[model samples]
Target chain A: MLKIIKPGLLTTVQDLGRTGYRHHGVVSSGAMDRNAHRIANWLVGNNESNATLEMTLMGPIIEVQEDALVAITGADLSPTIFGKPIANNRPIFLKKGSIIHFDRMKRGCRAYLAIGGGINVPKVMNSRSTDLRAKLGGYHGRSLVAEDILYIRKYSEHTKHTISHLRNQANQIDDFYQADWSVGRVSKIDNTYPIRVMKGRQFDWFTKESQASLVNKQFRITAASNRMGYRLDGNKLSQLKSQEMISEAVRFGTVQVPSDGNPIVLMADSQTTGGYPKIAEVATVDLSRLAQKKPGDMIDFTWITHKEAEQLLIKQEREMKQLLVGVQLRSYR
Target chain B: MEYKLSPMGDQSILIELGNTIDLATHDIVQHVVTCLDSMDHAWIIEYIPAFTSITVIYDPVQVLEIEANPFKSPYHIVANIIEEQIQQIAVLETKKQRTIEIPVLYGGEYGPDISIVAEHNHLTIEEVISFHTAGEYTVYMIGFAPGFPYIGGLPKRIATPRKTTPRSVTPARSVGIAGEQTGVYSIESPGGWQVIGRTPLELFQPNDPEPTLLQTGDKIKFKSVTKEVYDHLEAKLC
Candidate 1:
C-alpha cells in the first residue's frame, strides 16, 4: 500500500487500455506510453498489461505504507525514495514509511510506476485507465490527489522472493540517480530523431508547398498540449481546398491540420471522429517516443513507406522480447 | 463495389471498400465486419469499421508468421474472405437493428440555437421541428463522443449548415444538424452544429449498463415532446 503525500500536477492509473469500445466513440484512454507501462510491470514479474500508476510530467510524492518492491519507467523525473534518490527504469525495494517523490521531468513528459501485484482499481468498460474528458475509469474516474491511498493486490510468495532477489543485488544510491537497469536496451534515439509519418487519408487535400513544408520544416511542440492532442507551431500549411469534410473516425498519432493550416497531432484522448483533413499519421512504434517529447521539443517529420514502418515495429517488438529474456536471466541475481 | 487495402499502422490495416454513403454501401460495410468476426483469425484482435473504411487490428508478428500459417496476411485474407463471403449473402440484411425514438423539445429555451437553424434553412421553427421529426434517421456511426449518433435520412427541406461561429459549450441532448448528418449531442462540449432541438434522453451514460442508447444500423426518429413531458423524462433520467 502507498499513500499519496503530494500529488503533483496530474497523476492517474493506466494500463494497455480498454479496446473494442471505439464503436461507442470511446478512445482507448490508457497509458500514453504502452511500452513503458508494460516494461515496468514486466520488471515486477507481472504481465506487461497490468494496471499501474501513470505519473504525468510532474509526479506525485508517495509514502510507502508497506514494505514492497517497486519499479519506475518512462520519463526520468528525478525520483527520490525516503529523501534518497532512486533511479528510473530500475527495480527497487523500499523500506516501509519511506516517502517517494518525482520532480518534473526535464527531458520528457510522463512516467510509469509499477507495484508487483498491479493496482486494485475497478475496471470500467474493460479498462482501469482514467479518461478525464469522459470522466470514466481509474480511481473515482479522476486524477489521484493528496491523501489518496492506492492498494495493490499482494504478490505471490515467489514474486516476493524474486523482488527481493533483484533488490539485494541492486546498488543502493543516496538520492536522485539514473536507472541502473535501463529500459529495453534500444538506446533512446537522440534529439535529431527524424520522426517517420505515413500519408493520411486526406494527404492530398493540402497544396504542394504544404506537403513539402511538412516534410522539410522543423516544428516545435506547442505549449497548448495535453492528452487529447499536441498543437505544433511550424510554418502554417497551405491547404489547396477550403472544403469541409464529413466527420470521420480518428486515432492516436493522427496529424489533423485545421483550416488555419496549423497541424494538431491528436493523441490518446483525442476525439473518436474528426472532420479536419488529416495530413499524416505518425507510425505506431514512434508514438511512445513521441509521448516522451516535451513542449518546445523540436521535431522533423520524414515521409516513410508503410512497409518500412511495419518492419521497424516488428524489429522493435523482437527487441522487446530479447529485453524480457535479459530481465528473466538477471532476475536470478 | 471496389475495395482497396493499405497498411495504416503497425497494428492495423485499412480496408477502403467503398466511397458512397447510401443504404447499399452501409450494409456492405456492416456485412464485411460480421463476416470478419465469424472468421476470428487468431492474429486479428479487433477490427473497427466506420463510414466506408474498415481498420483490421492484428498482431503483425503472429499474422505474418510465414512458416506456421500459409496465410501470413491480414488484409489480403480479410478482403478475400469478405469478397467470397459477401456473395453468399445475396440479399443484404435490410431489416432494422433497433428503432429508438428520442423525445425532444424543439424551438424553446432548451434549444437556444433553434431560431438560428430555422433562419439558416429559411423555415419557421415549427416547420423545422416538423421536418426534422418527420424523417426517420438511420444511425451511420457513433463517434465524436460516446453515444453521438451520426444519423442520415434527413429530408432536404431543412438541411442546414453548421454555425459560422461555434459555441464554446452546447448542453447534452442538444439535437443538431451539419449538412447531411443529424445527431444528438451526447456530451456538453464545444461544437459548431446547428441545434434545432433538445432531447430529454441521456444519449451517453458511461456508468450505465447501457452506456450508449443506439448502435450502428439502429433507426431513430426525433419525437417532439412538450416541456412538461421533457421535464418528467429529464428528472426520471437523473
Candidate 2:
C-alpha cells in the first residue's frame, strides 16, 4: 500500500485507456505520454496496460507502506528519497516506511510512476483511466488527494523475481535502490523539434494563407490548456467559406479550429464528437512530445505524409518491443 | 452507396457516407457501421458512428502483426480490408427500429428555459409543449456526452436558438433543443442548448452491460407526464 502525503497539482491513475465505448459518446482518457507510461510499466515488470500514477507539473509526496519495486519515467520532476536523488527510466526498490517526494520542475510536464504489481483500482467501462468530465474510472473517478491510500495488485512471477534480484544487491544501500543502467530517451520532448502533422479531412476548407500559416507559424500553448485540449494562440486561421457542420467523430491529436479561429489540439479527454473544422492532426509518433509540453511553451508544426506517419509509428512500436526484451534480460542478470 | 474515405489520423479512418444530414445519409451511415461491426477485426479497436460519417480507429501495431506486407502502410492495409468488406455489403435489409418513450415534465421548476423557447417561437407555453410532443423524433447519433441522444425531427414551430450564455451546470436528464436538433443530457454538463423539460428515466447507466440507453438509429418520442407520474417513475426506475 502507498499513501499520498501531498497530492501535487494533479495526479490520477491511467492505463492505455478504454475502447469500444466511444460509440456511446465516451471519451478515451489515459496518460498524456503513453510512451513514458509503457516504459515505466516495463521497467517494473508489469504489463504495458497496467495502471500507473500520472503526476502533472507538481508531483505527489508518497509514503511506502510496504517493500515494493517501482519505476519513474517521463518528465523528470526531481524525485528524491532521504534527500538523495533517484534515477529515472529504471527499476527502483523501495523499503517499507520510505517517503518519496518530487521537489522541482524539471524536463517534462508530466511524470509516470509504475509499481511492480501495478496500482489496484476498479476498472470502469473497461479502463482505469480517470475521465474527469464523465467522473468515472481511476480512483473514485477523481484525482488523488492528501491521505489517499492506494493498494498494489498481486505481483506476477517476473515482478517477484525482479524484486528479489534488486533486494540482493541493496545490502549496502538504505531505504531505496535503483538499477545502474536505464532506458535511453524514447522520443525527443524538446520544443526545438517541430511536431509533425497531417492534413485533416477539411484541410481544403481553409484559405491557402490559413493552411500555410498552420505549418509555418509558431503557436504558443495558452494557459487555458487541460487534459481535454491545448488551446493554441497564434495566427487566426479562417476558412474560405463558413459551412454548417453537424457533430462528427474526433480523436486525440485532432487540431480543430472553432469559430474564433484559434486551433485547439484535442487531447485524451476530449469529447467523442465535435462540430468544429479540423485543420490538421498531429502525427501519432509526436503525441508523446506534445503531451510533455507545458503552457506558454512555443511549438511549430510540420507537414508529413500519412504514409510517413504510419512508418514512424511502426518504427516506434518495434523499438518499444526491443526495450521490453532488453529490460527482461537485464532483470535476469 | 457511395462513400469517401479519408484519414482522421494515422490510427483512424473517416468514411464520409454523405454530405448532408438526412434519412438517406443516416441509412448509409448505419449500413456501414453494421458492416464494420460484423467484421470485428482484431486490428479494429472501435468505430464511432456520427451523423454522416463513421470514424474507424485501428491499432497500427496489431495490423503489422497480422499483415506480412512491409511495403504497405498500416492505414492502407486496414483501409483496403475495409474497402473490400464494404464493397461486398448487400443493400441493407431494414431492421426493426427501437423507439424509446421518454416521460418529460415540461416547464415550471423542471424547465427554466421553456419560456425562452416559447417567446422565441411566439407560442404559448402550452402550445410549445403540445408541438414538442406531437413530432416524432429519430436518434441520429449518441454523442457530446455519454448516452446523450441527438434526436432529430423537431417541430419547426418550436425551434429556438441556443442560450446566449450556456448554463454552467445543465441538470442531468434535462431535454434540450439547439436549432433543429433536440437531446437529453445524460449527465450534468455545461451546455448551450435551450432546455425545456427534465426526464425521470436515466439514459446513462455506467454499471450496466449496455451502459447507454439510446443507440444510433433508434427512434425517440417524448410524452408529457404530470409531476406525480414523474416522481413515481423516478422513484421506481431510479
Candidate 3:
C-alpha cells in the first residue's frame, strides 16, 4: 500500500489503455509514454500491461506503507527516498514508512512508478486505465489527490523473488537499495531523431507549400495541449481546396488540422471520430518520443513510407520481447 | 460504393467507404464493419465505424506471420485480407436494424437554441418539430463523446449550421443539429451544435453491459411530447 502526501501534478494509474470501446465513442486514455510505463513495470518484474502511476511534469510524494520492490522510469523527476537520491530505470526496495518524493525534473515530461505488485484498481470495460474526460476507470476515474490510499495487488512469482532479493539488500543502504545493474528504457532521449509521420487520408487537401512547411518547419507544443491532443504552433497550413468533411474514425497519433490552421496531434485521450482534415499521422514507433516532449518543446516531422513504419514497429516489438527475456535471465542470477 | 484503404500508422488502417455522408454510404460502411467482425481474426483488436469509414486496429506482429515465413510488413498483408473480405460480401444481405423512438420535449428552457434553429430555416417552431419527427434517421456513428450518436435523415428544410459560439455546457440528451446531421448529447459537454430539443431517455450508462442505448447501424425517430410527459420520464429515469 502507498499513501499520497502531495499530489504534485496530474497523476493517474494507466496501463496499455482501454481497447474495443472507440466504436461507442470512448477514448482509450492510457500512459502517454507507453515505453516508459512498460519499462517501469518490467523492471519491477510486473507484466508490461500492469497499471503504473503516470506522473506528469511534477510528481507526487508517496509514503510507502510496506516494504516493496519498485522502479521509476521515464522522466528523471529527481526522486529521493527518505532524503537519499535514488536512480531511475532500476528496481529499488523501499522500507516501510519510507517517503518517496519527486523534486525537480531533469528531462522528459512524464514518469512511471511501478511497484512489484501492480496497482489494484477496479477495471472498467476490461481496463484499469483512467479516461479523465469520460470520468471512468482507474482510481475513481480521475487523477490522484493527497490522502488517497492505493492498494497493490498480489505479486507475481518473479516479483516475489525480486522482493526477497531486495529485502536482503535493504540493510546495505540507509533507506533504500537500488540494484547495481539497470536496463535501458525503451525510448531514448534523442532530439536529433526527427518525429516520423505518414500522409493521412486527407493529405492532398493541403497546398504544396503547407505540405512542405509541415515537414521542414519546427512546431512548438502549446500549453493548451493535454492527454486529448497536442495543439502545435507552427506555420499555418493553408489548404489548396477546402471542403466540408464527414466525421470519421480517428486514433492516437492522428495529426488533425482544424479551421484555425494549427495542427493538433491527437493523443491517448483523443476523440474517436473527428471532422477536421488529417494531414499526417505520427509513426507508432515515434509516438513514445512525442510523449516525452513538454510544453514549448520544438519538434520537426519527417515523412516515411507505410512500409518503413511497419518495419519500425515490428523491430521495436522484437526488441521489447528480447528485453523482457534478458531481464528474466538476470533475475535467475 | 468504391472504397479506398489507407494506413493509419502500423497498428491501424483507415478504410474510406465514400466521400459524402448519406444512408447508402453509411450502410456500406456498416456492412464492411460487420464483415470484418465475423472474420474473428486473432490479431484484429477493434473496428471503429464512422459516417463513411471504418478504422481497423490490429497487432502487426500477430497478423504479419500468416502470409510468409520470414515475416514481411503487415500493412499490405492486412489490406489484402480486408479487400478479400469485402469481395466475399458482394452479395451482402441487409442486416436487421433497430428503430429506437426517443421521446423529446421541443422549444423550452431545456432547448435554448430551438427558436434560432427554426428562424434559420424560416419555419415555425411547430413545423420544425414536425419535420424532425417525420423523418427516420440512420445512426451513422457514435463519437465525439460516449454514446453520442451522429444520426442522418434530418429534413433538408430544417437543416441548419452549427452555432458559431459553442455552449460551455450543453445538457445531456439535448437534440442538436449541425449542417446535415442531427444527434443527441449523451453527456453534458461543450459543443457547437444548434440544440432544438431534449430527450428523456438515458442514452448512456457506464455500468451497463451495453452502455450505449444506440449503435452504429440502429435507426432513430424523434417523437415530440409535452413537458409534463418529459418530466414524468425524466423523473422515472432519475
Best by lDDT: 2
Global CA lDDT computed for model 3: 0.88
Could you give me the TM-score of model 3 versus the true structure? Answer: 0.96
Candidate 3 regions off by >4 Å? Answer: A185-187, B66-71
* Ten residues in sequence with the least summed lDDT for candidate 1 chain B: B66-75
At residue B50, candidate 2 shows an lDDT of 92
**Per-candidate TM-score, first chain only?**
0.93, 0.98, 0.98
lDDT of 3 at B128: 93
Better model by lDDT: candidate 1 vs candidate 3: 3
Quickly count the clashes in candidate 2: 0
The lDDT of each candidate is: 0.78, 0.91, 0.88
Q: Tell me which of candidates 2 and 3 scores higher on lDDT.
A: 2
Tens-place lDDT per residue, model 1, A1-333, is: 889988898899898877778878887888888788888887777777778898888888998887667788888889876556787776677666768879988657888898878888888888888988878899888999899998988685535776667556555642222325656455352446788898887888889988999999989899898888989987899788688675556788889998878899888787777879888989888888888887888888999876677678878889988988777666655
Interface RMSD of each: 2.3, 0.8, 1.0
Deviation of model 3 at A131, angstroms: 1.1
lDDT of model 3 at residue B36?
A: 84
Model 1 share of native interface contacts: 0.44
In model 3, state the lDDT of residue B9.
71
Candidate 2 CAPRI category: high
- For all candidates, state DockQ relative to the true structure: 0.49, 0.86, 0.80
